[model samples]
Target: MNSEIFSREIIVPQSAIDARGHVNNLVYLEWCLEVAEAHWETKANTDLKKKFAWYVLHHSIDYKASVFEGEQLKVETWIANYKGAKCERLYKIIRLTDQKIIIEAKTDWCLVNANTLRPSKITEEISTLFV
Candidate 1:
């Protein structure tokens, strides 16, 4: 398995909160996606996949603590592993104050030929970059 850690700051907006008044558990996944997208754009230097062109095959997450509205959070993600068409990424949300872990997440994605809409072998550039 290979991994890359990425860091970015995010604000927990009011709309991101649940009825319980903290961040909606599901919103954490959005955080991971944002971080991963930036990492990919930086490494791949492209966003042709940005629209609806590229998609995630799977997403997994674990919320460790409540992330409240107005809090500044750190989103950290890694390209954890890949095999054939599948690539797995992991994420963690940290509170800046005490460095507390707010969440853990993982996502699996596939690189596809935009025109064909079928899974394509990860490009050698990506494989080498991830390595």
Candidate 2:
């Protein structure tokens, strides 16, 4: 698979903001999942989806700046590496108004059998899409 970066635009809503008047920590995590799922949906085919699924193994995030309500942000994600059943993904959340990077994150995901929920090897066809 080729190393391709996927991106999406997101708006910070009132519900996403915490008492601190900025986006909550958990909201950033949710955004990470959102972009990841969008990327997978665009790349994975029907047969691939039926054969395997991805489970988040770990997530590491750094909050560089606070995002306020009604702000527009650009979320970019890309696959960093893949081995066996596991792959690493990297993300950047940038504020559109000022072009500031508000968050930097990485998530580790494992391929698993869709039906049994057991870890499964990454097939050559699937790997090609991300390389």
Task: Compare the candidates by lDDT and give the number of the best one.
Answer: 2
Model 2 per-residue lDDT at 56: 95
Give the count of colliding residue pairs in each prediction: 0, 4
Give the TM-scores of the predictions, in the order they appear: 0.87, 0.95
In terms of TM-score, how similar is model 1 to the real structure? 0.87
lDDT of 2 by residue, 7-126 (tens): 999889899989989999999999999999989989999988888899999999999999899999999999888899999999999999999999999999999999999999877888
Best by TM-score: 2
lDDT of 1 by residue, 17-94 (tens): 999999987788877888888887766645545422346988878778897889999999877777777788888899
